[model samples]
Target: MTSKPEKVRWGILGPGNIAKAFAGGVAHSRTGTLVAVGARNPGKAGLTEAFPGARILDGYEALLGDPDVDAIYISTPHPSHAEWAIKAAEAGKHVLCEKPLGLTAFEADAMIHAARKAGTFLGEAFMYRLHPQTARLVELIRAGAIGEIKMIKSSFGFAMPGFMPEHRLYAKDLAGGGILDVGGYPVSMARLIAGAAAGKPFAEPDEVVGAAHLGQSGVDEWASALLHFPGGIVAEVSCSISLAQDNVLRILGNKGRIEVADFWYAGGQQGGTGEIRIIRPGDTEVVEVKEDGWLYAFEVDAAGEAILGGKQEFAWPGMGWADSLGNLRVLDKWRAAIGLEYDIEKPAKRVNTISGRKLRAGGTAIPKRSIPGLPRPASCLALGFEDFRTFSSGAILLDAYFEAGGNLFDTAFVYGSGYTETLLGQWLKNRGVREQSVVIGKGAHSPLCYPDVIGKQLTQSLERLQTDHIDVYFMHRDNPDVPVDEFVDAMDREVKAGRIRGPFGGSNWTMERMDEAIAYAERTGKQKPGALSNNFSLAEMLEPIWAGCVTSSSDEWKAWLTARQMPNFAWSSQGRGFFTDRAGRDRRDNEELVRVWYSDKNFGRRDRAIELAKRLGKSPIHVALAYVLAQPFPSVPLIGPRSLDELEDSLQALDISLSPDDLAWLDSGSDQARARA
Candidate 1:
């Protein structure tokens, strides 16, 4: 905290009608003052009349650069919220963006990340959430006035007289829709009420389902969604621009129910009285909230106080970071269920990262090395994001990787049952970085592990990836029953046909099987298997991690890999939490870890790793990863980092230079560099 200011100087960006309401609210705030109004054309914007005595800055960027502006109130179109909010944070200005902080949860997450990175306050402009009326409602719910809430129903809607295709509410390119506009009022309230009933700040719905009437302009004119929360509470929410709704909120419980008419306009904009009625079998109660301040004034003050307090976000009851993220996620799920996606979220429109940065090369944290079969050099770590469900969520990490000089991605047909492949494909296509990327595609795992299925699955994987060829392909698993010729012959045809441009190998094939396949390929003049993906780490696997999984950590297997100079795209390169102190001989809670990695020898190796990590001034996990990277052969470790922090943590291994002696000591507390002299 630098110093608490008497008032937060505010600048309003995109001085439209909403800005008028917010600007009026600023006049009523105790913690804020109007500094400037930012617009594209300062001369014709008429800021003199709309916001008299306020400086008019030409262009949004000008406001961001203004040293006098302490905070920015972004009232831009829905699609530009993420852009302006991030830019403001980067420019060292606090951001209080208009509600529905972003069109999607991904955008909200990015905005929050930027705020956190910059140490600036960021808030969603949900005025009702900060109003005293909302506080009283929450207080009543928590006090059990409604007697164990079970259900909530709310609506916000109004009719547009005629079809106005070019209107902001109907324009597809502008991200015009009822759900993104007003649907959040009920959803946010429902979550808040549910949280109050549960005695928490907020609660997210377990499931969100919706139905929308898509107008001719391809925007949701009216929509209704159901949010199912934990403990059997349900919320029914609706919003419309082409039709009028009651615009009321109702909470139902076992003993009684509460109703608030026009809940969204609580305190009535320019300040008046708002009523909440509680009804029971034979008794009735009414709670009236009175305030003399404008509605948006509460939000402005809330943000100002948070910034002045050196906090990065508003406290509960206000739309905090997590609350805003949860609300946007609910909105995303609702839109997905109703198949209401705007053009901007599509691949064609998302040509850059949400940060709006185009990926550039050569500022690498993870170094690149050549793989025999890949057309491009593979990063020391092949990113495995097999759990991603959406493009926006996954692309953030992908963009970070690409910008950090990572060129390799690992995916399989079996992962997410092919959704992972599609997501990877969408990310690559949207980012337009396929030419510089090394894609590791895998197929034919388990129940369908056959030579013929390899080609078929490869075709499907290619289509899902939106690519004509795979850089380095692999059969996800090998079938011992099938002849080596069948597998060798099948993949050879793919390579010859230009479908597999790099080396095609097996993910979990045994050493003997791999050697036999190599011999068969050489004898038949076919493309030879050039890589093996097995579990390799400081502590070797004692048993199969998966049904057909293999470990190349044994002495003979390592010797063969070293002699052949074949690359091992090792998965679980860091022993899958073996070096993390949480895993030990006493702790057998993880059955897979116990079943596959537990042994007296492995425990000694783990201890030696901790000791060596101390000497190297790094963590045991970093030492474990470095051991894999510093292997004698062309070994590329595949790291599956689930978040940006984890990705950065994995990159720490690249900096640790592990010599052969260090590797030998990490593998075992051996006096000799090799297992035996």
Candidate 2:
């Protein structure tokens, strides 16, 4: 006996024009049905008329909370797609968001992460790809109908005669541009065709060169890009909002060429013959393909099947997570080349009004420690600004940290793609405490870890931090391939130029590398590295936390730092929650903690910490932090607190102190009194 197909109930978020097409597609699909339509103004003209059979909801959140809705079709504007898609996933509903998936690749990453965490399906809605004609095109290319594919040319453009500045296509704040809007189509099609040549689902371009014509509204009216993919495949793609183009996709190979006119509209609204033309030396042939339903219906059916199959992403002709990410990454590079930035894309300043409590700078009297070169003292702990997603949410925790005596903010160029720095900068400017705070800026992370990126990223970081100079600058990562002297010289340039005033150092750098850098700086009469940021705590890391990460908690590393009297900014100094009761040998389910910190030796250290905490009337976690602070060399631990309560709990660690004998006993798991003797 055969089982009946599972019925997937769909909800439409932001009942806009595209949403009507999606709802119509779902109505035509066998496995999917539209049950609800949500809009901020549900009573607006044409909304109810468009989705007559579906329940009209008042807001997008209402659709997410609807139990009968199994999945949501997010047709919101580009800027709002990421937020609503994440919320829908968190609410246990699968999502099919409109493209481009988000305003930036960073935003897309966040959406993918949320869906994966929720174990829900997420697919970007590029309706053309799912159409039968696209599949036929891919099959023909893979079959070598066009032998040894070498070049691809695709364009999507239309003329907006009376362009409105506030319209999404022209509004920079809404991430409106030809590149992010229509440009994605040509890019996706090019990548898809290139992937077919390589026998893979998709392939990313190795190089991209883009040019754009920015209109009066500060958004791209027309843009073009040259993309170089692997396997000697090259493509030239273009899109425009104010200029009309052929809107065709042409793939040229050594032996032949194939062209598809009105590629994006094929098998969709036209309701006509879908044609692919092949041109060879002797003859030109036309292949006509027929479609059964709207182009959007294919993606609807595909998403429903994936959800029923318990897959987190859609398969071929459908967008997987990596495919979405790869496409967005290409767009990011293209935008960078053309220098396109959106106001809504920037981090907004948020006011913290938790319980109507106003933020006052100094409330808890946090202890400050002196650094080598800076005249101002930094807080013993640095506030890590990576976890909070929104500026207001982060501001609440930032306010609490400041009230508790935190003047040092830890941020990096890679942190939320500079969103963290933007948030901290807005908070500093809003609080009018830029001079009072110590900003620890970091740059030159992986993939961009070069001599030029060191200076360029630092300049962007400084601008984001809203400060004239960074108090302490750190290379976020190290590349051993580059000469140590070159890295030193790049940093020395910044120091001499007054962009960095207090100290400069390396994070995740080994002791040997640090010595090499410092010695080279000394020999060249340049500024030496004054601090080192690495993992150091009671629980030893079984492996590097991330690529190129280093741990300084080993006995040899500790001895080196002590001998040199070098300041160490210890990250994950509290053992990354290892000292808490939540961690244990039997708790193998917490894979990250278990894989990083679970060991026989670390368990013994935890036991000793518990004993010390009992004697001092403090928590074991607090005692673990105190041990790092009580080290022989200058130690400042970075704290990442997700909430106000967690921040307050971390602050209590400042009051706990450990003597030399106590530290030795904790490390050696021996009696303190005997160790002192």
Candidate 3:
């Protein structure tokens, strides 16, 4: 006799209306069992009653932390799916999240990243795709049952008689809309059919044009879209919340058409029969599909089997990471065309009550420079506080900087694993100086360099910085794989929404890439990058200190900046401690300094700087920083200081100014050349 397979114990993240259906499905699934139900409000109407045999947990996090729960089914609202799916993946549980997996492709990418990082399974719960009829339809289409497929038409919608604005169906904060709720069905079906015709698991639409009727609550009520797929295939998909639709799917071909009524129930609704009709010239055929259980049970069983088989996602139904992300990309574009936006996705202006240590208007003021497109003048020196580990520790140096009239703070998402931003937020909130401070938010670092991550990371950064708008946002790294226009459009959306004020640009992008991005923005009538951040110092870099790093102090780069008059925020502006006496010429003693900035050419420049510093009675490091500030174009150098003393030492560099002749001599140590200039 064969041994029975072990059942997968499941946990439900939310106990709501749709979760009840998932509970029913789980109960009927052969390889799945409902072990726990997590309810935010345990006293709610449907917790114990909907899931009788399952343990009632107090919160979603509690359920995820439970050891007995091997898998989690995320049945929360669309906006909450990404967060909890990521949490579940981090907790090492297989995840089955509801459709419209995320509000945007960025969220989907983040969730996918989490799952892949944790080595866990994560599948979107498009239960209808697991139905037998969907499989048969794909098989027949590939077998030429529908010869030369050309078009697909699908829709799903329902009429709510008494639509409440506060209901999840109409609340923008809850990510409620016809497109995110029911429109995913039509879009997914259309993509699946197109993929079938092309002999692939799934295919993304090439072009999408969408229009919507938004309700008073600002949520889409009725939306329609036309998608152009590969091989000249077109699909007309529609969805509605206040109006009823046919709720059917049809694929038209040159030889025949396949029609599916109530396609979302293709596995047989509650143990009933599903029918697909084939119509050709002068002939008609009916195909009946039978099921042994509920329609949703198939997805539950499939998820469990994939987990048992050590698969990250379902194979036959094709609810993998790529499919989920591609579907979200199409939806994101469609929503963009229709102008349907959720308020929850917007950056909120945080208002915190101040308690201690009030800020004064005027003090030891730092020199300010005006960058194009920025409403306010920025301090020429920005403080890099990524290394501060605690609020108390960061607050002292921050207080000293602010009191000294330094306002700009540079922080990135990858900094201190987000602790740096949180500390900055706390300090700003405590001091009530958010309005006066200039926060430079950097995001989309290497390996996470997708265009969608720009918005997602910016949102998180804003929340952590205790402000709605970043004065100057920078992409921390460049991703050559993605087109420059896509990056431009992503930043444009953030700018239009008021999340970023102006002067957004790239941190380490080459001049050519920056020009390409600016041209694309100008051609598309979008905002162009107004600033750049690159390495610039008196001591030249022999190689990149880190991967994908670029320097703006090269002769060619400096000339370009001078001609364009662009602002370049110079990072490592003092040569990463290369100008100090602690760095020696011996490559074996200081390998990092030698590997990065120790070429014969750089050593010669350092010698020139040392001589110039001796003549001017200043530190060589001070001369290095002063050299950066005295450039032909706008140059703001970033300084990372660990304490008040370090900050004061850095501020001393502001006192030393370099003349054009002095800069020329420092570059080549040629006194005759300085005279010629």
Candidate with best TM-score:
1
Judged by whole-model lDDT over C-alpha atoms, candidate 3 comes out at: 0.84
Lowest lDDT block of 10, candidate 3: 347-356
- In lDDT terms, which candidate is top? 1
C-alpha positional error of residue 595 in candidate 3 after TM-score superposition, expressed in Å: 30
Q: Estimate each model's TM-score.
A: 0.91, 0.66, 0.58
Candidate 2's TM-score: 0.66
- Give stretches of model 2 more than 4 Å off: 1-5, 270-272, 347-438, 441-464, 467-557, 560-567, 570-677
Model 1 scores a TM of: 0.91
Error of 3 at 554 (Å): 8.3
lDDT of 3 by residue, 129-247 (tens): 88887898898899888798899999999999868987999898898889999888899889998998999998899999999998888999999999999789999999999998888
Error of 2 at 175 (Å): 2.2
Per-residue error at 146 for model 2, in Å?
1.3
Tens-digit lDDT track for model 1 on 197-233? 9999999999888999999999999999999999999
Residue pairs whose backbone atoms clash in candidate 3: none
